[model samples]
Target: MNEKLKKKSAKMTKKDGYKNIPSVDELMSMKQSGILIEKFGRKLVLYAARELQSIMRSNANTNTKDISSSINSLEEIVNKYVLKDKTIINGTGVIIHTNLGRVPLSSESIKSINSVNSSYTDLEFNINTGKRGERHKLLNAYLNILTGSEASYAVNNNASAIMLAIKDIVGKGEILISRGELVEIGGGFRIPEVIQASGAKLIEVGTTNKTYIRDYENAITKKTKAILKVHSSNFSLKGFTSMPTKKEISLLAKKHNIISIEDLGSGLLIDTKKMNLPNEPTIQDSIKSGIDIVTFSGDKLLGGPQAGIIIGREKLIHKISKNPMARAQRLDKSALSALTTTLKHYIEDEHLIKIPVWQMINMREKEIKKRVDAIIEEIPNNVRRVKGTSKIGGGTMPEAELPTWLLSIKIPNINTEELLKNLRDLPKPIIGRINDNNALIDIRTIPVEFDKYIIQSLNKLNKKYK
Candidate 1:
């Protein structure tokens, strides 16, 4: 160290070190600070510098090595806040991954969103009559044809759709639900809580494993207003489990003069069985079973934008639409546009080719193997092709797994966690899982266009870590 710097280090005490830390203004004067300011703007750069200063002040050794290093630390903090919602590559092979932004929009859907969002068409205005119109009407015809329902309405998400229906239909009345159907979806959102929040009494009937139609019928009374059937979309009950059929539940609800509502959490419009996946109930089948009101998610099996679709009898949907909560929970123009385009793909029998979720699900094992083999050949890392299974994630068909091929990578010097971290630290992060002390990358959920990024990230890691 230099003579003057050595003296400064020697004189630095705990309190002296705290005072020695650079001020936000002093740090902002440095050359590195200019780069950060240009990228994140002055206000954010100043905030990040102060945040770092606060963190250093709390520590006894607050004396930074140099101004350059302090600015670098500030850059790291600012990047974290700025790129909090940045897009990432999904190598985890979980199609419809909730954490990774469930159900990526198709090219058509993206074009539709960009087209409608860039300028203005007719969001709430009727172009033909030049009058103010309802936004939900845009999707009504598409949903009616897709689900064969008398009418349809959309909200922000499936939970909102259910809440609106329950609040409007069973106001202050009792709502009967099967004990097994009292489900807690992702994010700890429980069915009972929603019912209670909707200003209705939750009466859970039957046992957790067995809920017969008689159990629902016996629970009805003068206070009963609706019978709720929540699909176990995120979970499965295997052996010795029993529940009444949708038809039987619908019949019982009709016999009692109460509404029959089904929350088909992941609304499936196509036949999953044909894709070799486990048989999942479809929205069409639910409506066909005489369900009075059916609710589901638009982003799950529908492969659309995030939305809650409510479709059933016209009168019931109209009643729910008039509720004040409907205005608060309604979908915006961009989501409606994207959802409409996604629905058109299905109507044209092009979902398998046009939707990302279905494309990943329908991808052949041989095609995936070919891609994995090519990725292994491109990178210099010690990677090999291995057999793996991709899951249908986002609370739909939890137990189902699709056969896939993955690249298993092992670096000689780095551990699994460090290797994974390095991959995530790349410019475009690569998200993968570890198995048997090796990093596993499943390309099933990744787009073909992003394959180059995987190759580049792995090569960078091999050069640095190896």
Candidate 2:
């Protein structure tokens, strides 16, 4: 053949190689494909198959081995595109871990959620009057008993709660806030930004360390509408730091004939000092101090669904609830159901025993050590019991650390990072931390029911690594 013709023929042969690559129809006929289709829907499986075919064609190789390997890659592609939010074993010992779905609902709360989610509910229907009812009044009685507030409202989250309060009460007016009390909550949501978003002017007063009540008084003018006090929930300022008390701020706002609002970033119903942790002010404390309005999170320290709860005087709460944003930020039926159940736990004086957040917080060190000892006994590897600390995470308590026991695993010839990855790759991913080149599993955040999954994962790792 001529040189040009030879080159053309070679290119043709290479192009023909792709003819052996499986089509979407052919791939869908495979038994393995049927399994994947059953696990993931047909549409996803088909998309994965088409993607695999494209990859195989791009490589310009369609040998039998390559085709078989590409077929096996179908599941990998589908898994990669699948939803990643699933049940995970949190061995990270940080109770209320934000990334792991902070504040796991109690059994009662879960039951309430499932009950409300699976069927029609009286969410806004007034069965007593045979007419439509208001959902906002559902939690009033529960919150009134818990926080001693004249009225209460719940929105989607704490940020929304504060925003609604500011916009409704202080629109186009100056809101005084101490420089030290200006805090940024989780996800970079700052107090000043919230104020600005509400169309109100932010008057930052005093230094970052010290802000007397006089500073607030000095900042107030004819345009001043409210005084905002934000709790530094995720951080603490130590020596030389001084801010006015909640009572003082409330008194100052009263003297100026303006609103007083306090954002207790993580709202607490129970006392933390009783659990041997640092004192965190409760929602009731804010109300008792004569604050006209209080905002706090339901998911963080409250051990409820993600909600922004506002409690204050009847008139102030009524005004805030009348804002159009309140409807847009209101909680759904499922969240309200779960939150009501959670509140019931407190009302019945069973919060520490029934609510998962409090249960995890109040977990005794000896009980945690016992679980660690049992886990170490089950895993036949280079695992040892070690002392560690559990944190009250989710931007609640920055300085509180509870004593805990950890299972430190150091397998031969395996690095700590690789070990953690392997554990994560298991069916039920086990999330842990590294300590001094060793993999540490702190079971403080893990419930006892999930211990078997951890044991199984560790045993499987031991066998594979050994």
Candidate 3:
């Protein structure tokens, strides 16, 4: 260390700035700390106090040698810990945003989650028969009712579902997959890595841009146990790109007596073909086409909690269920409860407008404009409406765009970045896009329940930031 820095460090003592730091017992005695104690107990508060002391000592030169500043710093540290994992608004117009907790569950689903989590549930017991039963029975039943799959299973996420299936069906056997379909999903989850981790051999066929049915046929050997087709959900390859259809590959698998497994990553059950959106495979289509197994995500287009759903032939699903990894990667009671309610909505044909993801996708531009107009009417000074687009994020429908209307806010002297940052610091922070030197908030992604909140937030922003 530099001599001057060492001298500065040495100059700090208990009398200088260290004396200002509060004791854990002293801070806990305050009325504000009562709320924290009820929420996070005394141990955590003590831990926060120790962390504050460490930070205060490290910056002793800059820290004010006063009890009030130290108490303020302690309160700031406590508040930071309290709100570290709180939810925020997703005004960025990305539906199913992975970073912001993909696919906000419906009110019914949320209630189911709370119900199952708040009390004891029949999660693993069959009350009808008064016997031990499987946990995924209701979930599987809904998947079968909604997608016509003979059987189904629910795991923690799609990757674990794929891994469990491969480990059970094709362990130490060759899995024929297209070179183009070997994709890396969010958080560095690559198809090849998942396959290898499942103890299966990956045999890449065809080229990056194209893979014909003949490619799969040629790659098949005695060791090949499964033909894996992964939907490139997060990205699209345009221009001269080609891959074998699920039907064609399933037919080939049938002829060869090999398994055909398609990982329809973002599990869209709704027919969006009428919407002119880019084609995304559905579990129903793959299962109807004789695909042996289809796996997908519950959080993405399924509009459910984070889960990996496996639906396929009963024999294959039974085999997968027997694997030890099935228990290790199984969904908890709360997630299954939420997923069951979500699938019930889909099965009853009520999800077109009930599910948040579908509601956002099918939301009319006029509807968004109406909401935007309401916001602008409330805060008429600096906000105006403009045309914009929203994305079906969370690695699904990468090329699909929903026409949306956005609120273009112009606070007189506030720069775009600072304005956005300040909005993000609110009680329910607003996240928006910066376009043409203005902050744009898409109303399609914002729920109607938060309409007044958004309006009040913007008005408060106008006054506070200015």
Candidate 4:
């Protein structure tokens, strides 16, 4: 290979010298700071170091010292990439921000996680029978009570729930989905794509903007095994849109003896329709709507761990539970523990207000203004108050406008983008937006407790420029 054609190394070590690759202790103590993502930091450094040594092994004039230097440089590169990745941030006015990591678990959930993580206790053992037991048995009963389903189990996410369902029910047959309901999610998590992946044929029915009950009936044939209803969780179809309700689809599936499943992408437990959060059907409602199977995200609206809830007839759930794929996609004990804690909170009248995520979501404009005032009070006098926008994230209510307030600080000399990046680079990064040459900190998304920290961070940032 041409020397120049290869990626250039920033520097090379001397052929032989007093210095060699720094020990792990030396690397840890070095003033040089880069990134610090979980295990990736040390792991990548060693990985890169080994690869560099192999690459240099073939080249003439290669020496031990040069290899050491290559390792050091790779270590640095790994440091830069490994800093804690995009973590769960409760910003963006979205309680369940999918991109930022959905559903911050409750204190009780955290306790449960710690309890489970500390030791393994009957994850698959039946305590009463003194025999091997199903892992899903623990959570299935609670889920059944909430949804009134004959049986319930969980998978890793909403997509896997649908995938496992189709694999179990529609193998070697057609899975009918509404053309309009054929939807896409983050990372191209599409319904049609999932249907194709499930070893089943995609039978799309209905129109994008409008599809009648008759349209679905007309499309069904001997090959069809399942009817799919996917909620457009991320976006809304506005104006001149007509689609069959879940009730209608359920009835049709019943008459044809086809399994019906609604992938309630970001499913909720309680009805937030009263809050004017768009009417995404709840799991209970979907069950009542007469669907045989309902799949939903545990993390998105439930304010729990990231898992997929499958509620339906026990026979079907049993079939799905037995699938080899189910074993691969099952939630860990920690996730199950966290979910139980979160689900238990729903039994109270003020459950939504008590949980941090729901508490933030239900915060009123006046409440935000009060919190914004606290944030502004902590900041330097130059910061200005401005009205801003925050969305109900996790794709629940596309049209729901969260009334909010923002504190905008104009920093001279430094670029706004650079300033924002630096802020995010801080430990426990504070994420906000830049607008009108000001870094806007929308208080609606920020919790009241963060008021002091937000101000303290700004005070430090302002000093850097001064």
Candidate 5:
């Protein structure tokens, strides 16, 4: 430590440090304080002041000569808390990016959410009969229309849906699942753990690389409640891998008179073929294949609010809905509203024009190049065009890649990492992938509406560098 720092530390008592702490009202009068108050309210400003006071006390032993610099630090701290829930630009080509809010809700869904949340809604009331109604009933018709299922139920998330299903139908009973199909998705949610949490015993059958129909048949006992099939959406096993088909497993479950549930992790509603990609089995296909109960996520591939949709045989769905645990996992009015609109887009065949996920997935190279050209026209220097790939993220289609155009940036005096950090630290953070010692921004993931913001951010960077 410097001699001056040492002497200053020796002279300052903890009480002396407290005396230097600024009042919350003093911070409230600083530049950008009104913006902070509007963003986080006065309550958070006071909280931030106390936090800063604590930090000042702890660091009292060193450097307190620059009061202006310390105030700036406190202002920065307040801004960070205000931006905690703000949206950032996804220049990173990973669509449905988990870390950055998986599945951006469509505008129509947002409208629906706003409409429902702005005022009183018929959340649990039947306007038709002037009677109390079920909350899940709102999605039942839309789900059945889009999925060809006899009935449907809504929950807060896929994990809760699965837990309720098992606790209702397979409590303390055995659930036969293929060892090959056992998967650990993002956030470390393992299939076996979920089953165990639901009070069901997992009956692992066959090898990790292969499982035959007979493997499941052999494992079935009088205690067996269901045949559980988990779609390993996040990963795949190549070469010499085999697992029982949905048809085979469904037939086996039918013969045994037990429930069959398929956990379609991504819950893709659109046919991948229509998007010029390989097929992911749709909920309709699962129902046709005799899956008695099906649970899937609403956000991934569906491009809706976070939810778990359960749609299958009417009897089984009713039974699952009747579970006491279902109430604990029920969807709120906002989620239900968003999900209903999202499903309606599919039913009305308006998703192609309305849903962002499918629109981005089907983006052509020519279209992406046009977007890139538009961006380059504004800020041309150091922005190199290149061929790159985007992904269908959110633990779905781990192998699927979308061909696209990308902008690789090289700021003259700054390292790529620092440049990337600068973009991320912008007022509206621009998130991009680092490739080949450059920051690669995939325009496919960037909405056309944000093009001006991207240009403005780059222009500001250019000015700063100049």
Candidate 6:
């Protein structure tokens, strides 16, 4: 140590009523050829110094010789770490929060997934027929029962479903779509982009805000191969806007000898009208609309695994099944198992409540209020009910902000934004809103296990602020 630093260290220790302070080397083991020191010189020294500093800070003592041994022990335990894509709790109220994983599998579906994944009887092998059989057949009857469609098939996601159909059917031909329907989804997936990638020519019809049936009819040419209508699930055009319905588009496609495809972004298995959500066409309703092919997501409103399912006329599905890309987009045994189980829950309709996404979406105002009341019972007088908004996020209902009952806290220590950030940093993060300097927790999204943690967190925040 330098003369000045040495003197300062000694003086500080003396003032603190300490008898002595050991030299850095004295605290460490005797150097044996300094091999470890040569390998990790600064790291070893800094670690030992910090350990000594910790001892000094707490007025504790340690034989400094154990410093190198601790580092060696830590180094021995290190191993290669790999990142695996897996499940995470969605604290955000968007029932199908895309980024946090679109849906939570039902207990039954999870069991099916485990069973199929652990052992394999037939992903491609046909056990019954003892020949090469279609993998989609496993999920076909289940989907047909739910959607009233003649046939069904599934790919990895909705985008693949669209691509598989168009790439096989509309090859080397123009496909017509409305400009207003060419909306962008989360993570930059767009309609025009997908169409172009499928090797199909883009024929845009109608205006951005208003597209009529006549516009589609005008766009039709000998080169037109298909007609695509997309639901603007992320946005809505209100007042002075008109668009053609499925029937009109179907007629236009029929007259032109072209297939009509309706891509329902948030495809719901059961009606959520009782939950006060805007009514969108279900998979069954789409099939009944005279549409040639219907594509939708399994995760969004159906609350299942991530999949792109196509249900429609058996002829079109057969064509899609034969495509070269079908191999790439096909679902695995796990997906089939989970999705089949998820679709089966829709058979009785009443079992919808058993699904977490459905339950959260259908949570009534009275129920949310009850949860809020329970939360208030545990929290201090500092937190109270504040009128606020909740969202059906994940791009399903962009125009919808669920009227949520918020329990808010007014704290002085941390700013509202920082307080929310801190809550989000918890072990199982708590996500809430900040408005008018109050942190609002919409009881709608909080899981049952998190209730006690939320109470403890609120109390800690109150104590910190006080």
Tens digits of lDDT, candidate 6, 307-368: 89988999989889888798788888888878888777877665556677777777777878
Pick by TM-score: 5 or 6, better one: 5
Task: Report RMSD for candidate 3.
Answer: 3.5
Over 4 Å off in model 3, which ranges?
A: 1-41, 56-68, 83-87
lDDT of each: 0.90, 0.89, 0.87, 0.76, 0.85, 0.76
Root-mean-square deviation of candidate 4: 5.6
Candidate 4 vs candidate 5: the TM-score winner is 5
Top model number, TM-score: 1
Off by over 4 Å in 2: 1-39, 46-74, 83-85
Stretches of candidate 5 exceeding 4 Å from the true structure? 1-42, 53-69, 83-85
lDDT of 5 by residue, 1-466 (tens): 9999977767766557566666666666766566667767888776777787678777664424445555667776776676464878999899899899886888989999899989999998989999998787758988888888999888988988888888888999999998898888668988889898899999999999989999999999999999999998888788999988888888999999998999997988767886667568777789888888999999889888899888888888888888888887888889999999998889889887788888888788899999898888899688878999999989888888889999888888988999999999987899998988998999998889999998889888877887
Residues 334-399, candidate 3, lDDT per residue (tens digit)? 888999999999888999778999989889888888888877888958888899889989988888
Better of 1 and 2 by TM-score: 1
TM-scores of all predicted structures: 0.93, 0.89, 0.89, 0.84, 0.89, 0.79
RMSD of each: 5.1, 4.9, 3.5, 5.6, 4.0, 9.7
Query: What is the per-residue lDDT of model 1 for residues 365-391, given as tens digits with 9 covering 90 to 100?
Result: 999999998988998658889998999
Q: Which stretches of model 1 miss by more than 4 angstroms?
A: 1-22, 29-31, 60-69, 83-85
Comparing 3 with 4 on lDDT, the higher-scoring candidate is: 3
- Which 10-residue window of candidate 4 scores lowest in summed lDDT? 9-18
Candidate 5: residue 50 lDDT (0-100) = 72
Estimate the TM-score for candidate 2: 0.89
User: Model 1's lDDT to the true fold?
Assistant: 0.90
Position 148, candidate 2: lDDT: 94
